[model samples]
Target chain A: MNQKTNISQIAVVGTGVIGAGWIARCLAHGIQVIATDPAPDAEANLRKSLQQAWPSLEKTGISPGTSPEDLIFETDMAKAVEKADLIQENVPEVLELKHQVLGAISQACRKDAIIASSTSGITPSVLQQGCHCPERLLVAHPFNPVYLLPLVELVAGEKTEPAVLTRAESFYKEIGMKPLIVRREVEGHVADRLMEALWREALHIVNEDIATTEEIDAAIIYGAGLRWAQMGPFLTFHMAGGEAGMRHMLKQFGPALKLPWTKLEAPELTEDLKEKVINGCETHAGNKSVTALAAKRDEFLVEVLQLAEKYWPEPQSIMKK
Target chain B: MNQKTNISQIAVVGTGVIGAGWIARCLAHGIQVIATDPAPDAEANLRKSLQQAWPSLEKTGISPGTSPEDLIFETDMAKAVEKADLIQENVPEVLELKHQVLGAISQACRKDAIIASSTSGITPSVLQQGCHCPERLLVAHPFNPVYLLPLVELVAGEKTEPAVLTRAESFYKEIGMKPLIVRREVEGHVADRLMEALWREALHIVNEDIATTEEIDAAIIYGAGLRWAQMGPFLTFHMAGGEAGMRHMLKQFGPALKLPWTKLEAPELTEDLKEKVINGCETHAGNKSVTALAAKRDEFLVEVLQLAEKYWPEPQSIMKK
Candidate 1:
């Protein structure tokens, strides 16, 4: 919708949940979306999802002239992508399927068209294989409910052109997204790796009966979850270090890395790693002191706590039987 | 302040960050606090921290008759805990220091008084080893900025009485907390385990140069972090699975657990673990269908995204140089 981005037409190569979400988000932004899926009921399902998502999108605000009718559905992948300036592939996670689909999309789409995958786990370099114009392919992984959440991780394949990433970044930003360009290609990208670590540990806890799903949910909704909404673990720990900030935090709690706290093995707290963490936090804090940052955090928490109370589900009794 | 809980005077056994947070939260609830610390400047630091936390607490809501002056300071741990209905121990994480401090409080405090440790890692049973009346000692771990965050993980030692947990739960609820009674005591308990897993993975990402801390934080704030404020991972994933809910989710993404998505090894997703997770999500979902829950989540995300934009830091350019 931003006239400068020059990406008015987007091809959505799958119409499942993530695909449908992408379609709805692009449509809400007044971008013409040509969606394709092989499933018999894909169109009906996609329409239902769009109807469900539109109200929330409307509340959030929509690009002028935006409407669900702006979207067009096709059963043929080649037809769906041939004309689009950008093709967003949201097919299943199977590697063979992705290679086959991306290959088809690459061959059929225009030479300059950008190819982005919504693959959560596969590395961009791995996905770039078997694709025509591999330099145009990159990973633009988005979280669920694509229309509302602003984060979209942009990872470049080894063969990807920097210009392609730049173009993709601007286009996503114009659609109201925060594009985080990953430094290197890795399995699960950035967000999913962090989430999977937590998920794996959570599975361990459940398997061991340390807590029920409800109790685990309570643990998050009421505590760290609230803080994480604003700050990541590093910044949170920096504040926890008090006035000295992360310098004192690493000194104090760095020993806990050796403790059997999480099943995941922590990277050795080498002097280099320590400096990286402390420096990263100090840099992120900018000119603000830990006290000043804590004040801002406190103010934010007060308002968010109230906002959350209105929306959070009723507290389930977590008493041990 | 809730007359039914029968807890009025609370002794804070340390005046560090966690201890000061307890003092501020208790004082905000109109509960008289007796705080003690051996450090030369403990009282001054505690007072300063209380002043910093009070404004936010006031904004959130303060109990009737709440007064900062209601608190008294003592140099001796025994003196501080004596005559108090509840004693909160927040000494340094050193096991020896905690054992010594907890022992003194236990010997001096009322037999019926509840003794809770704010220890983030050490198990309650380990701390109770040197204490008199170990039945009263329990771990009541709270998150940072304790005045606002509502979650408190309560873990009881082998010697602890069931009645103590019951009484502690009511007291925490009265003071505006969601008490998650951990089923089994682990090194870091429930919330921290989840957090530590994520933190460890984040550190690996940073160390490996996959992303910087700011990029990692952005990954959260713009996506999962927004959702976590209202729903934890289980319910969030349930909605991600579409109308079929968590059952469909497990069938789809369960294989990712076997993939090297995270450093932490996932537990074997046997039939039992799968059922536990599926059943837990269903029970938590109650009668609400996944579609209904997704709608609620979408609504919450819309409002939270707006709220977060006001408080979130200006987006740092995460592009690779």
Candidate 2:
């Protein structure tokens, strides 16, 4: 499906970093954007975020032009969704807020318009529960610095239409994203849940003084992490077996299966733990502002994307049996 | 310390892929190398690997112009280690063979010369148990394509000398590696254990027909694996928390902590499993020979190393408390 007939006008609700990012990305790819957020300064904030996003996008040779002045920033949600082919909701994580936004967008947008939520952990079913037309609602979770990172987890809720998912996938591909359809609906989808497990354990290690945040980081980036970037855990281990392969590796090291893992039973969010975490992050983060750190992250993400694109060009077509 | 005063010669006692890799890295940084292997054509093989390694090294500007002519390959272990400052043993992973080679190298090399094993999983203490001078022997495990990847796990044996560890660390730094002194000796040191866990699980998935090898690889590389290249498990999670940090992440999803991981207990190396593994690798590997695959791996590794050097330059001095 080509972009002209399939995806043209896109509505981005809630002009936060993610919302503004969607607008920037869509506009960069020549898709017209209509954005909405409740706050009085939301339009101004989105304008600023878009301005900052433009140069980086330009560096990748995909400019959204001199100014996003052609983009519409509507205060009314209905007006924002009126002429949109796709609605990307970036509202807050609260169930009540999501229900309200999705319902409003569904009522105003075209019957076939794909409505995708940018929720990281909330399941599609829960978010679609309050939608007037739940069939169009699905989770399309993108990583931070959305314009750069290629992954977008497309999850279908119980009520999501199959056609909605196919159209959403096509839209993502057009905008330069690698979308993986999660077969089942689980909390946190696929990527976030696995990440949550490692993260939870990492926190426990930090709390227990087994390792500092920096040390824990060093353990991955400088060690197994370098290999992980190029190949996943399994292929890496497959090679680790020398010529013997995975079975050999497993058989040799199988006895250590019962070693205690650091996967902590989720701790109660005590006030002390909160302060400890904040302080820990602040110490390593130094005086750099959040915007600055984000910009730095985006810069690195761009480099990594360029490298991957150069090495692994996508297969032209999938051969079906 | 500058290179002049701390000038050292190294004996690379194996002339295989790893041994030649060590030679390339050491000599590129201006250290003299004495390589040895019992294979009649070991010198020829070493020359071939070096020729393959040069272009990438040159691109990184780390190749010290010394030719293969500068390297001395001998069949005699005594001649190889006679006056060496450091002896890196990359021999086959047989205990009896290691014992024999290490004993000879220990007897011939200078008393102060640190003898380091390139064993990925074998603990140094066990390897050094039969050595006459066990105090000088330790494990200096480098990842595959050692010349490119910066990480080198330096694990000390029970009888390993503290001074020897210090000297090895300094030497590793001089040759441009991020040497981490693993505090406790564990099988596979640190990285291998984590790799083994993931690998064992992957084999189980493939063995059970849950996922194909390529699918599992795509799951990681397209998802969590990409983030890992730049940040570790903890830092990446810390960022995942948005403004709430790790505590919020843990508190939200800690209840699922007890869910059984798919990480299989190492499988039995049955004849069938071995055959399956061999055939699986062969089919997936396609037409490339082992040497060809190794060469491809080396090329990618060199590119990654150059990129890493450009982005994350090793700090001259770490802050000390």
Candidate 3:
């Protein structure tokens, strides 16, 4: 829908962590950003986040002339998107609130302006309800610390135009993001669903008292986690099968699928299990706070990402350089 | 059992990929290695793998006097373990073969020697069915490119001495491995089961034709895969939940586990799906061969592992440094 419209000026609604991350990413790409949030301290928080994210984001590589000074904030929703080429809504997950906010933003934006939601699980169709121009609404979900990660999943609603999807895809790519066009709408989208499956299994492991949080983390961090960083389960298995690839792997170990390793439904998060999980996390946290761990994670992530780009260079990233 | 045994000389039975990997890792760590295999081309393949692995292993870091020339392969298992203080058996996954080979290795080695089976899924209890001294036997599973990945899951069987587990842990650590002492022995051990679950889900996605190999790979490499590089799902979601941690996440969306996103039973890998998967992989492979991808994976894995060591700073790896 917005394939041809140049998204030079972008409006980001909701200055939560996700929204602040978006602002940092956009600013790093040299985009003029206008952000809006109702929270009393939203502007200050956004500024703090940009400062915190600057060091790692620089490591991720920024466009020439990128600066934090280009960012501006407004409290009024209509005033925020008054001149926006694109609007990225990052409000809470409540469906009704999202619908109202999206509808209001649509009323403020121009006909060609693309409006996207950063909803992790909610479908784009639901977000389009009561919007003035439903054809321009879509989902452009991204991970945390959005400036570092190259992925951005774009999901199109039923009322959305195919042209708009293409436009959004091109725009996202132009900004140095890898846009994964999810084939169909699902509760958690593709990646989150797969993650949820693993998450449920992890919960089952801890809930059953079979292993602690630390053991589960070790089971991944020291092993499979390393592999997944570069390849998915499919290609990974294809490699694991040796020269023959995925077919050989399927035939050899297909029967193991029947094993009761994963829980289809999540086990109840009982008080005891919660306590054990909390204690386990505290033990593993050691002297590092969550913030420290997150910073370390981000630092290594930038290194890993830079390493990835070396082997598999992307055109968009190259364009920025 | 082998707590005090001087593991200067190591016997590697069955010089397949896993065995060659173990040999490469051991030799790089400056351990004297003797390997045995019955296959006519085993020696040639092992030599080639050792040559292929050295460059990356060197990047992983090596001891003062480590060299490929220190590796010796024998045709007879008894001669191979003649002076070995540690024997790593990597025979095929066949239970009967493992029983025979492990039993024979135990008979040849000293009573204090530790025998480790590199069985991916088979239980140590089953592998130790007819062993001479099962007390010194346990499972020490490592991922592919074993020279780089720091993880080594050590699982104990019924007859395995608790002290032997501790000894194996220390020995593995001495060799620059992060040995995870599996609290209890189960099928596929701990990491493999988690990997298998993801593997099965991947197979299902491919079988249903929901997404191509490249898409599924994209879904992972760009998304959940990033989080996995440093922390497992428990820790990842704990961070995702903001300040309240895992409890907040569990309470927020624990019910999404019952969604139809993941198939409990892997869809039958029909001929069509196999062709598509192979074709998809070929497409994703682009102009590169599996061998090429593997080499690149290893190169990047070495970098990732090195970065991980910098943060975690494992004693074994640091000892070599």
Candidate 4:
């Protein structure tokens, strides 16, 4: 499972925050990188960003021979991407701009080179529309601070080769990532949809003046946020379901789904939806009972609580700030 | 102000998961507890929960003089509330049942004793409608495994005295909790509203067959969840905005708010809302620059990623079981 990525050299197309992040991560993994950006000061900015991120990357253990100074900054996109095995495009999230940059990169890069987009919203199918060889294009969206967070959602375009996805998965894993292969193409993908939902609700909370942004932040940092660090909503609720797991939880809180708890209208809690949710959780829990899973959660929470106390900024005294 | 709560002796009504949690937390804080529930096996179940939680509580440090053995169980609600300084109710989340139980406890308890309901959906205003001494009742909702999570959203009713909310705040703070004083009463309070929004969207994802429960959980455990433990969404985005902070972020990604990203509809990103969010984050960031904050965030992520790797269950491979 820990097989090395055959991809030894890559080109990072764009030198913004996300592009710099990819450079830092790949450099830390000892992969050679050529980064290209059209902005006048992109090279200096990316260099500075790498300098800032290097210490942290080192703490996470940098690869043997890679250094920030080893990066190549090319003003010409074609020249930069020509020889690399993969080209990670992190340009701004506009469709026209992405199509334009991607079109140029696809023409220049090797035919077998993987063209991965860091787009948070656009689908890979949409992104691969006008590419030279669309079969090699895929969406490999990583979270912010890409040097650290391990998730990289891998979504294949309609024209993408299955082998391309398989290669991308191994390459991403080789660079210390957990690639979640999205089964369907949708706006915001999986993680961002969940995040955007919470973000929208949070914005509404702020709009209505129910709580300040600080208080809302405190609301998360102190409670659900701590647990989220270890488990997603499904597994967390599975443990909360007690001995019966999701079966009991859906029964108990299922009705509340209809309540005007959030502005987001919930799906009908039909028997089919209920079984899918329950079965999903039961399967995710595996050999562990709810109590056993809960014990592990509690142990994780105890340590994370301490870590949070140390890192979470001193919140403005409730509403008193 | 870490003032010791004036609440020394407390009553826990309805010895279910939440009530037992209250008992465990109280005992750990050295408070005297008398818990009451009419169910046949309530006491036995509560005792078992306490035993399971005690080891974790001990790791968080227990008050010297108090232990789980000091708890008293009474089947009669009147006897439970009569002598205690404060009574924490954790009954099932049914309106009529809450009104009936609260009506009874408000009448039987000491006139000066504070009554707090752990209702996740119903507001305190509705819960106090028919209760005797309604001014003493407020909503003090705690998350699951309440013994560990530090957040408690405190909402006061229309008839409740401001002084009672003041006391409740100090009391929850005294118990090693972060009490978020919700300014406006609404369904699900603050945190749960955010959580419910995410949960609903997650269900939609599963219903649409976008991803499995395991992949969804992996989406979070590896990425946003790690950051969430230390910084909530506002500050997280704040740092993502780079040098200009949230100000720059809104300019960059605010248009996406209008896109159909999540099932939930986002509020119009009006200029007023923009300033409020930007101001909120800027105030929260205080003297730190975005780089400084990102550095802190990176350091925390490095450690938390290690913690998560150790604790997060082995996720099933991407799309394959």
* DockQ of every candidate: 0.68, 0.12, 0.19, 0.71
Return the DockQ of model 3: 0.19
- State how far residue B22 of model 3 sits from its true place (Å): 0.3
For residues A1-321, what per-residue lDDT tens digits would candidate 2 score against the true structure? 244347888899998757877887788878888999999999998887687666656655474353566688889889989888889999877789899889888889898888999997788999988898899899999875565555688889999999889888878878866677776766666555445445444444444434445544555665556555445554444444434444444454333333333222223334443333334333333454433433343343334434533332113211000
What RMSD does each model have against the real structure? Answer: 1.7, 16.0, 14.4, 1.9
In angstroms, the error of model 1 at B177 is 0.8
- How do the residues A258-301 of candidate 1 rate in per-residue lDDT, one tens digit apiece? 99998999999999988999998888888889889989999899
lDDT against the true structure, per candidate, is: 0.89, 0.64, 0.70, 0.90
Candidate 4, residues B1-321, lDDT tens digits: the string is: 124557899999998888999899988998889999999999999999999999999999888877889999998899888998899999899999999999999989998999999988899989989698889999999999899998899999999999999898888877888888999999999999999999999999999999888788888878889988889999999887889999999998899999999999999999999999999999998888888888899889988887877787765544332
Off by over 4 Å in 3: A1-5, A258-321, B1-5, B258-261, B264-321
| Docking category of candidate 2 | incorrect
- Candidate 1 residues lying further than 4 Å off, grouped into runs, are A315-321, B315-321
Question: Model 3: how far is B48 from its true place, Å?
Answer: 0.5
Best-matching candidate per lDDT: 4
Q: B4-66 in candidate 3: lDDT tens per residue?
A: 445688899988768988998899888889999999999998988788677666654688778
TM-score comparison, 1 vs 3, better candidate: 1
Q: If scored against the real structure, what TM-score would every candidate get?
A: 0.98, 0.71, 0.79, 0.98
The reply for model 4, stretches above 4 Å from the true place, is A1-4, A315-321, B1-4, B315-321
